[model samples]
Target: MKTFQTVRGKLSGQILLWVLLAMSTTVYGQQSPITISGTITESGSGMPVAGASVFIENTSFGAVSDFDGNYSLNAQLENKDYTLIASYLGFTTQRITISITGDDLEKDIVLAEDLLSLDEVVVTGTGTGANRRSLGNAVASVKSKDLTNNGATQVDQAIAGKVSGALVQQNSGDPAGGISIRLRGASTISGSSDPLYIVDGIIISNSSNELIDLGGNSQNRLADLNPNDIDKIEIIKGAAAAAIYGSRASNGVVQIFTKKGKSGEPKFTFMTNVRLNELRKKIDYNTVPLAWEVATDRNNLATVEVERYDLQDAIFDTGFGLENYFSVNGGNEKTSYFLSASHLDNEGIVQNTDFKRYGFKANLTQKAFDWLDITGGFNYVRSISNDVPNGGINSAYGAITGFLFSDNSIDPTPDESGVYPVTSPLVARTNPMEAVDRFDFNQKTNRVITSIA
Candidate 1:
């Protein structure tokens, strides 16, 4: 009787725990989602303003204005009063406060052009700053809008083609590989041709860091920077333009400004993107068999015509990539804060090649006293990639040689067991498909940038 009573008590306790969990879930789910519908238009023209950013304060609920300047956002009815903000690239930001009640809400916003863009403040090579109109020097400033417009996975990629006189080329097709940025032309034959990169008044290295097995593959450190965290960039393309930075700026100078908190209610933003990479051009191969091209059967020693294999197509395939970012910027009269985090996963067109990165940043500023202002920031990034080897005749495992050396008759397709059998006698290198899948070339790095002033 005592044992039975103990067992019954344990069973009853487990049942009670489940019942409480279900009850809490029911109560939480009871909160209905509120829908906010609105149309955005230009103030002067009364025309639709599409692609405007609309969001609720301090929450992940947001939507973009459609082509017709119409937008609708669903917000959870957790807060009694919510602040909604609408922003556009060339217009002033608009904010409205409201309380969520029973159901749907309607709001229409009008934005006026910001003339201040003409006289935008610009930081120069010298310690002094001036507006764009006053400055006589030739300087290129890239802002947040330009960076995010193309959805660049790497910060350097965003500047490519966008900056005039800049010749930016990625070293390899590998997503995480190095980038070659040449300003104007090479200034010196011996010195480093790469420009000097400065972020938040500190110099950052952009040298290639290649390891073993990867051969010539290298990753430029600048590729590690998260594009979303940047607010603006100033590029001094020529050596003369970077005179203030001294000799180290021989290659030119690139100054990066990180995003800072603005004085307003807390605001939240989330962005996601997906991209596909396809092989547009393939090497044309001779489909017909070459005369006198014959191979002997291993078992019978009988000569047989070679079978053609489209190794190029088998080696290349469609690639996909994904990116996600979240940020919150807000502050009060004296204190301000900006926090952001992002993740990227890029799959390369070549098999077994991939790049992944994670980034986080936090900036805080406080006006402790009238003359004593303080600022601090923390940044972190983690990168991972498979450094696949390139094709070359010198390398025993060169992937390219597997296609060139083998006769067209040899089949390179993988079998049911996912193995590429090396059946040809002429091929000295490992099967290209097998080599990429088997080789273990990986790159990983963790970096942190912090400041306090």
Candidate 2:
């Protein structure tokens, strides 16, 4: 009987030990942490996308991807039904629903680019990227295709009426006429009100005084840039949008981005255009008889009959323009190059006025390392202008003063007297033809601009 009791007590202790062991096992299972690991990649290229964020839906548990686009998260998941979300900028968000148990789980997600979404950002203000929908400022972007389609000569002219809130005005009818650009109306009380121009990360000085003093009284400096070489243009209107550019941008800012070579098979492009330009409008001058009668009345002299002259008919003519361009681009994955040459000849509607330019450009880009890129480009342009004397005394304006309102018909050629025979009230005024043949005004300019990045 004593032996039986001892065995029974031993069995009771063993059963109690077993019950405690089962309870401890159940509690451990409920508190264990599960690890979730995964990798993220681009759907199309299958390239790993680092810096992606992965998190459980509606929870504070999350992890960030490492350099290899791998992530690991630890969580004490209570429910089997839970969702994992992975997101990154410029890519579509990915979500996966799965059951969680007391075990490690592995997941791999592939994301695609969000092309249709306007949320894709662009750099508008200096070094700042903003969504297109949230911007309050007036900005317009013109692609390379637009400039080519319009056959625009200058960058500013390419964006003319197409963009809202920006005004482009042509000051003259000449082929080389000046253009005026205004952003949200004139803001300054006095001084130049033109916008600032930035080309290829270089801020160019657009001093109005300089334009007046050195540019032969041109309206803006944007005419210095050729449209064919431009890759894109961004116009920032109003002070608020251009504040970062400082005082130079008081009017506004126009940023120009030039084209560079692309890596691919060797490519060649050639284009030529032959354009004809005629006088769009003519200014009517007073008849010779009418002019002489008016002059006699003003001078209170006896009736003097004057010969008539068609001064307008003799000064203007139909002009022609010809342009030619050729380019060659070829490169490998490590290096690329682009070279272009262009020639332009344009004649003015007015006699003895013309413009010619020869330009060449070369751009090279090299990938020195995975994260380092180097680019260098240069442009050389030489222009010649054959200009007529149009202003000042004894100039084109003077010829108009003498011929149209003269007291007598004047012949443009010299008579046997070796003196310009005048039929007008003034004898000091020379014939328009004689002045044009004797006066020759010509100017030549050569410019070289280069950039390194």
Candidate 3:
């Protein structure tokens, strides 16, 4: 009877201990922590992107990438499924379904460049988006680097020879004058002849024709824009390519894209240039006699006294120019901004005639939300100019009627009545100094533009 009682007590005690061990294990399993580690790289270059964020989909557990794009996290659970998210600016997000185990987990992920992916998308003729491979019409794209390669002053000049099936001609070498562009020959005989210019999704009025007083004579509107500020230019040559732009685009369309900020540290740039201008061709006056000899030769026909005047020498002077530019660009993941200022001063080859301009520009873009984006930009300019009078055949400085050669004895100085002394009509017609003093004109322009997407 004593042996039976002892055996029963020992069996009961062993069973109780087993139950306790089972309960302890259940609690410990719930409390064990999990470790996750991963490395991130660019899809194309296989280059690690440091500072990328890696975290659980709906939890606070997260880690920042190190220099090698490696990250680690500790979680207080095991044998469970969770969503892991990795993100970096300028790259597409990466997600993976991961089941945690008691042991440490490792993963390697690659992210695609978002800009390259977005660029591949194409837009249909009906304002709908399509892929580039599916398009049927002829289309071309001009990159920003290509526009900036050659030092061109105007965007039209940059595209002159670079593009095919387009004709660009400069009618004259006048500074700030217009350039003529014809795509596939003349479509209209009496109406506007130049192609329409679109800038940053806005239809800007190009006054190349109006600049010359409705074809009377004027400068090209394209020359008003500084080419250095342009990012890219796209040309639509065919009717099929310009169908989306509506009636205004019948003559073809020239689209311009300006520079914007990128995701990077703030950068500052400065550029300056100095140029000298001289007469491309010199006039010959050796065949003409002195003003006195001419006056003596015409004595029989002259009723009023003829004085000497050196009009040719008084009209021309040495020309010099200077240009300066400074800019800054920077941005965070959500917002980017660009600011620039420039100054241009050009002295004309004609005495006392010159042009000066100062300009300011800014561009700002913000990712207001996940599906909304906003952009705004502005340009302001102030200009002052002094031009010689260009009138009829007898006009003082008309290129066609102005005398290239004049007699040497004609003095340009004024007489006692504050009036320029008159000499022979062929030798000296008007005082060039008087014409410069009387002609002066000033103009200023300011432009503002904004868009949302």
Candidate 4:
């Protein structure tokens, strides 16, 4: 009887212990894990900023803002102070400390843009970035945002009219025509007047090296660089700013920096553009207000009369162009990568003249340690340019002004054999329109560039 009574007492004691433990567990479970929710916005604009990280200080608990900049996080802690940190690229990080009361809380945060972004770093003699404040001479810098706002298909064209004390002129309207940039006026009397070009700490030539004849128009090798891939441009107009480069930099200097990879989640972008160019007006001579005779029908004066015709309408066509670009970027704390591809198709104001280009670029960066870093870049491009006979004083072969002296009575149309009929086959000057089809000037090139550091 005593054993049975002891067993019952012990069982009752065990049940009481279990009940107390269950009660304690329930209270502990409800003690913390407070829900916090809010929106992250720009300080002055109050605009939501997506993709910003909202994390608890000294803990892994965090959340990323949604498309609308809304975020929610559940954190467990006692009634004590906890720090919350929010961070994003190109913006100042923000922190907030609050005491948790084991209840839901709503807090909105406003972050301001970092103002130091305006002062760009320049490459110095020691291969390191020098602060803008330390430079003795004035240096003009342009960033990617500015390039995007302006249409710069070619790198040289990117700075056209944007820089001070600089002259950027296209040799001709031909697609392959070169762009000449002269800073601080004439540096020399004869030898190449182009400024020295540097890309990523490496000296590159921007000469118009002509391998093929496209109406004798030389192409600037700088055009091979895709403006979409550039991150920044610095023009050293003052002599003090270019003293490090020496006599090669006598004309001045132009430094181009390519875009690099950033650490973050994978991001994708796609863009397209269409351009059209129409001739607003043309120059032509009036019909003289009286009948003009050609040698062919001078015998019959009454029957042979002048007929007015618009030559420009028959020679030129509407020019249109199309462009497409795609890019992908992403990275972790250790490694990052950027990839891009683009294509362009441009038509000239004159018929049968056009240009096309294709480009691809890739860049990668890896941080092996705090002091050791590695970077690599690769690029490939292909282009095609077609042109017709243009320029000069020749009346028979000139594309622009050769048609000036042709009589209005003569019809400059092709016959059934696809041949332009001239006023007279035996005359010194043939129809200028026939020269357009007979002459051909086209060029094609493919090149690759790579670098590592």
Clashes of each: 4, 5, 12, 0
| Over 4 Å off, model 4 | 1-120, 131-134, 211-216, 289-305, 393-398, 401-410, 415-432
- Colliding residue pairs in candidate 1: 306-409, 307-409, 308-408, 308-409
User: Model-by-model lDDT, in order?
Assistant: 0.78, 0.69, 0.64, 0.74
What is the clash count of model 1? 4
Query: Which 10 residues in a row give candidate 1 its minimum summed lDDT?
Result: 290-299
Which parts of model 1 have CA positions greater than 4 angstroms off? 1-121, 130-137, 188-191, 291-304, 392-396, 401-407, 413-430
In candidate 3 the C-alpha lDDT for residue 78 amounts to 50
**Residue ranges of candidate 2 with Cα displaced over 4 Å:** 1-120, 205-221, 287-306, 392-409, 412-436
Ranking 2 against 3 by lDDT, winner? 2
User: Between 3 and 4, whose lDDT is larger?
Assistant: 4
Better of 1 and 3 by TM-score: 1
lDDT of 1 by residue, 37-80 (tens): 98999865779999999998898999999999999988766637
Q: Which candidate has the highest lDDT of all?
A: 1
Error of 2 at 306 (Å): 4.1
Candidate 4 residue-pair clash tally: 0
User: Would you estimate the TM-scores of all the predictions?
Assistant: 0.67, 0.65, 0.60, 0.67
Tens digits of per-residue lDDT, candidate 4, 109-189, equal 766564323465566546665667776655778787777667666888888877888899877555555788988887778
Could you report the Cα RMSD, in angstroms, for every candidate shown?
15.1, 20.6, 18.5, 14.9
